[model samples]
Target: MMAVDKGARCLVLNGATLGATGSGVLALFSGGHPLSSAALEGLSATAGMASLCRVLLEQAGWEDGPGRIVAVTGPGSFTGLRATLALAQGLALGYSASLCGVTLGQAYRAREGWSEAYCITRARRDRLFMERPDGTVWAGPSGAIALPARAFVVGNGVSMLDLPQHETLIRADCTSPDPRDIYRAACHADDRPSLQPLYIDAPEARLPSQGLRPSPV
Candidate 1:
C-alpha cells in the first residue's frame, strides 16, 4: 500500500485554451512523486474541471485533512483561465487547503535545458502573451513582440509566430501548462502566488464602451 502523507498531498490543475484541441489535466502528487493523474479532452473546461477534481480525489484516495491545491493562472484562453481559477479557488476554500497560482510562464521556466527561454501563449486572435528571455512580459499582435536570435521559444503561440526557422523552437506536446511543471511551480513558489488571471485584454462585452466617445464641438 502507498503510504499517505497526511495533508502533505498536492493537487495540480492545468488546462488548454478553449477549443484548442488539448486536454485538461489534474494530478495528485505525494512528496515529489506523482500518484495519479486524470485528463479529459474535448470537454467544456468549465464543467469538466469540477468533474476532474472529484476523479483526482478518488484516485488519490483522500480521507483525512485537506491537501494543497495549485492552479495555472492564465496567459491562455480567457474562458479556460476563468474556469480553472474558479475551480481551484473553490476547492481550496472548501477543503481549507493552501492555494497558489502558477503563471504559464512559470511553468515553462520550470522546464530544463532552457536558459534563454522565451515563453509564449496564445492570447486573442493574432495576439500572444510572451515572456522574453530577460524575464520581461508583453502581450500584443504576433509581429509586435521582438525575439532575440537563437532564443529558445516554447508555448502554443510558437506556431503562430511564423518565424523563419521554426525548426529551432522547442514546442511542447501540449500548448497548455504542463501538469508536471505546475507541480514543480507549486513546490518552489514563494509564499502563495497570486490567484489573479493574467488577462491581456478587457472582456469583449466592455470593448464597445471603451471606444473614445465624441465630445461636444
Candidate 2:
C-alpha cells in the first residue's frame, strides 16, 4: 500500500523498536531515493536522523529537495513505550513537517476493509493498548472491544473471539499503521513530522506502583 506522493520523498520505520508485542516491525519508505529514514534497533537509530531525512529528500529526486517527511508513532511495545515516542518527536521537529499518526486499528481497517476495527497491543499490568478507527483508545491488554460496525481490526493483541463486542469484531493481522494513513488523518500535518516518538501509553516502570520518574537530561 504505497503511493507516489508528490508530497513525500522518503520514509522510515522502527517496528522492532516499538516491539508491538506480536506486531513488532520496522519499515522505511524513501521513494527509492536516498531516503533519510531511521529505525535503529537499539539506543535510537542515527544520531541526527532528522537531518538525514532532509538530505535523503535530495536523493529522492526532489530537485528542490523534499521539504517534508513522514513517521509512524506507536501504541507502546511489549516491553514499554517511552523510548519510541521520544525518538519520533525529535525527528518531527527537525524536519519541520506536520505530524501525522495512524493507529494500529486503522491498519486493520486497511487490511480487512471494515468500518470499525480494534488495533490491540500488549501492555503492562496485563493490559492491552486498544486503538480504534475513530482514533479512540481503550486500555485493555487482553479483553476485546466491539469493532466500529464498518471497520476492521488488526494487530498483535487482537483476536476475533465471540464476545458481545464480537459482533463488531474481527481478528486483525499484526500490521503497523502506515505513515500515509497518519498523514491523511492529521489536520496538523503541514509537512513531515519532527523526530519525536509517540508512545500511546505509559511504561510500567513509570506506573504508580513503580513510582519512578523520568531521568533528567
Candidate 3:
C-alpha cells in the first residue's frame, strides 16, 4: 500500500452509475487541494472517459501523470463500474502510481463525519444499494429494507423508497456524494481497498446457451 502525501499529485475518478445520468467526474488534486476537474456526461460518458481524462491531465499540465489515483468502487452500473476500474488500473500501471478505492457511502460518511447513518443509492429500477450504519453493504428491493424508527437516510436513492410516516426519519439535502468528498476520503483512508468493483448484485446480462469460447493455448 502507498501512503498518500499531503503534497502528492492525485487524480480522482467517479463514474456516477448509481444515478440516472450515467455521468462521471474527474478531478486533479495537489498539495491536498483540488486544482481542476472535468465532467463526463451523455451517451459517450463511458466510451470517451479515457480520452477525457487524458485531456484533463494535459490541460492541468500534468504531463507526467498523477502520483496516485483514487476510484469509486460501486454497486451501480456493471459496465460503467468495470470501465472506470479498468481505466484506473491501466493508468496506474502506466504511470506507476498508487491506486486506492472508496465506496460512495464511505466517501459520504468520511466527508460528513457521520459515525452512523444509512447511505443508500439506486441499484436498478426497483432495487437499491444500501450501506448500513454498521458499515455492511447490501442490495435489494426498497420494500425489503427495514429502516429504524428514527432513521437517518442519506443518498440519491432516498426518493425511490416508500418510507413510513415518521417524524424522526431525517433525509439529507444532497442526492449523491460529491467527487471532492471521495478525494477527502481517499487522502485519509486508514486501510487501502483492493481496488475491486463492489458489486452487490449480479449483472443483468447472462451468458449464451453455448457458453463462452475457450482461451487460446
Candidate 4:
C-alpha cells in the first residue's frame, strides 16, 4: 500500500483500469520522500470500491490536499469510468488541485523491456481503440476504417473477440495492468480529461414499450 513519506509533494491515481475487461483498480502517492506503494485490490462494481479507495489513502497516512492528482481518460467501463471521473473531478475542484492522466496503451508502456509496444482496448466489433508509442497520436477506429494491423492487443478484451492471428491479432493474456505504466503516463499529463467513457458496445438492456400492440382477432 502506498503511504505518505516524510516530505512527499504529489499524488497519483490509477483510473485506467476502467478499460480492462475485468475490474482493476490502483492508486499511488509519491513525493520527494521515500517510496509510495499501496496495496492494489480488484473489486467488481458490487459496492464501496470508491469509498474504500479514499479510506485506504487515509489509513495509509496520506493527506489528501492540494497538489497534482492523476486520472486516466479512456476506452473503459461507462459506469465505472464515469464514477472515477466524478471522483477525480470532485477532488480537483474541492482541493483546487491540478489534474492529468494516462491512457490504456500508455499504461502498458510502463512495463519493462517492451519496446515497440502496441496497446489496445475493445471499441466495437468493427473497430478498436489504440495509441502509438509516442502516446499522443490517435491511431484508428481501424477495423472499421484505415490504419495497419496491430502487433499485440493487450487486455482480456481480445479474448472476447476471438479474432484470428493471420497477419494481425495477438491476445495479451496478462492478468493485471502494470502500475508503473500508469505512473509514466501520468507524468506526461497534468490536466486530465472529464472523460465521457467509450463503450465498445451499446447497452444490453432495453426500455419498456410505450404501450402494447393490439392482438389479431
Candidate 5:
C-alpha cells in the first residue's frame, strides 16, 4: 500500500512532546511548503491522529495518493512517542512510503544559524532530558545538571536552569517540535537511521515493586 511515487510529498507528524494540555501536533508538507498543521488538544492521541489523517486525505489531497511519513522520536512524553511512531510505521507500511524519525533536538538544531545549542525538555519531576551541543544526551535532576559556558539553551527545561550572564538562552515553545524542522532534519539524516522511539527514563507503566519481583511458575 505504498505511494506510487515516493517523492511526491511528505507528511510530518509531531507528537513526541506533549503540550501542557497533553495535546499533540500534526502537519502536512509538500515541496518544502506547509499544507496544513493542527494541534490535537484535550483529546486522545488516537482520536487526534485520526483527525489528522482525515485532514491529510481531504484537505491535503492525500486520498488520491500516498507520500512519505515522518514523525518525531522523543525523549518526552511516553504515550505521544509511542502513538506517533506507531502511526508513522503503519502509514509507511500501508502506503509503502518512506518513514523517518527525527528528534526534538535535531529539529532545534535544524534552525538556520544554530551551529550549536543545548536542547532540554522536562523529564520526570525535577529531572530533565538534555541534548548537548556535541549531540550527546543526558538526563538527571535539574539541580545537578550544568550547562556549558556560552552555549545557547532552549526547550521547556530552559526555565529550570539558572543561567550565568555569559550564557544565552532561547525560551521557545518546547512542547512540540516544529514539523518543518523535523522534515528538514530528515532530509539531512545520514545512514538512513532506523525509526525508533527514544526514551530517557523508565516508563510510568512499570512499578518499582515489579523490578524486585521474581518470576513464578
Candidate 6:
C-alpha cells in the first residue's frame, strides 16, 4: 500500500466502465474519507468535468486543486480510457499533484476481499477481458474463455457471457466496480507513474487498401 500524507485532498476518476450514454464517476477524498462525488453523463456533460471538479473543490474549500489524483486504467472502452487518462494527466500537471493509476480488476478484488477471483469486462463485440486470480490476463471471445468451478465473478461484463447453470458461480451485486473501491485499490497499489491505457485488443481502425499518393516535389 502506498503511503499518503494525512488529510491530503485526493481526486479519483473512473471512466473505464462508462454507461451506454458515456456516464462515469468522479469522487473527491480527504483523509481517506469521501468529500464529494458526482456521476457525469454524456460526452457533452463530461466535457465540462474540469469546471465541475473545480466547483466541488471550491465548495470543500480546496480552491488550489487536489493534492493527489487517482485514475482508473482500463481494459474497457478505448475512448473512455484515453479521455480519462488525459484528464488526469492535465489535472495533475496543472495542480502539481501526484498521480496514480489503478485497474478496475484490482479495485474489484480489493473490495470483495478475495484472494482468488475472476475479473472480467467487455472488450468489444463478443469479446471479453478476463483477469485470473493468479494475475494472468486474457482477451478473447467470451465463449472461448473458461472459468473455474465455483468461480467468484466480478465485473460489468458478467452478464454478457453465457455460463453453464450447473456450475457454481458467485457474482458481485454491481455490474461495475464502485468508484470508492477504485480509491481503495489506489491506496494499496504500487506508485508506478504510468498513464497508458491498458488495451487488451487491437484497435478496430485499419489502413485503407489504397496507399497514400506520393508527394509532389
The most accurate candidate by TM-score is: 6
Pairwise lDDT winner, candidates 4 and 6: 6
Question: Candidate 1: lDDT over CA atoms?
Answer: 0.72
Clashes of 1: 0
lDDT of 1 at 169: 57
Q: CA lDDT, every prediction?
A: 0.72, 0.47, 0.77, 0.53, 0.71, 0.77
lDDT per residue (tens digit) for residues 1-217 in model 1: 8676756788888764554544567788887778788775653756777876786687667855247888877666777878888877888877878888877777777777654568887777788888775556788988777776556778777878775655455555546656788887667885463488777667765546578778989
Candidate 4 per-residue C-alpha lDDT over 76-148 given as tens digits, one digit per residue, 9 for 90 to 100 = 5455566667777777776667776666666676676444555555443445555556654432444332224
- Using TM-score as the measure, name the better of candidate 1 and candidate 2: 1
Poorly placed runs, candidate 1 (over 4 Å): 163-174, 206-217
In model 1, pairs of residues that clash are none
Model 5 TM-score on a 0 to 1 scale:
0.81
Q: On a 0 to 1 TM-score scale, where does candidate 4 land against the true structure?
A: 0.66
Question: What's the CA error at residue 90 for candidate 1, in Å?
Answer: 1.0
The clash number for model 2 is: 41
The TM-score measured for candidate 3 stands at 0.84
Q: For candidate 6, what is the lDDT?
A: 0.77
The order by descending lDDT is 6, 3, 1, 5, 4, 2
The worst-scoring run of ten residues by lDDT in candidate 4 lies at 32-41
Model 3: runs farther than 4 Å from truth?
A: 1-7, 16-19, 165-167, 190-194, 207-217
What's each prediction's TM-score?
0.83, 0.54, 0.84, 0.66, 0.81, 0.85
- For every candidate in turn, the CA RMSD to the true structure comes to 4.7, 7.0, 4.8, 6.0, 4.3, 4.1
